[model samples]
Target: MSKEQTLMKLSAILIAALLSITSVAAFSHSGGTDSKGCHRNHKTNDYHCH
Candidate 1:
């Protein structure tokens, strides 16, 4: 393979990895209600009774 081809492949791989990481981070949940009746804010990560 040529140097250009190898670079392109590496760039594609890096882009794919970054996209996957970003997607996981975007969908990650920080705070939420548990089994009991409760609530929590994602931003504050604080739990409270409902």
Candidate 2:
């Protein structure tokens, strides 16, 4: 493959990866936190602080 084509492919892959990562924030569940600023993860049954 030519250098230009390889660079284009790499750029496209990088953009796709960044997009997928940023999209994860949109899926965060909205919930109430305790007095200590911690919440329970319903899916995992785990408690954590933000």
Candidate 3:
């Protein structure tokens, strides 16, 4: 492919990757924890400590 075409494709891939990563990180959890600062992942039923 041409240089510009390759760069555009790479940029689009990178942007999509970054957006997915940030969105998952931003909304990974939406629950309240107990006094020990831990919560359960309802989706996976796994408990984690923070």
Residue-level lDDT tens digits of model 1 in 1-50: 99999999999999999999888866644545577867777689877765
What candidate 2 gets wrong by more than 4 Å, as runs, is 30-50
Reference-based lDDT, each prediction: 0.80, 0.90, 0.87
When superposed on Cα atoms, how far off is each prediction in RMSD? 5.4, 4.4, 4.6
Question: TM-score for model 2?
Answer: 0.57
In model 2, the Cα lDDT at residue 36 comes to 89
As for model 3, its CA RMSD to the true structure in angstroms is: 4.6
What tens-digit string does per-residue lDDT give for candidate 2 at 1-40?
9999999999999999999999998885666889988998
User: How many clashes does the backbone of model 1 have?
Assistant: 0
**Candidate number achieving the greatest lDDT relative to the actual structure:** 2
Q: Which regions in candidate 3 have their CA more than 4 angstroms from the true location? A: 28-50
Give the TM-scores of the predictions, in the order they appear: 0.54, 0.57, 0.52
What's the C-alpha lDDT at position 25 in model 3? 68
lDDT of 3 at 33: 90
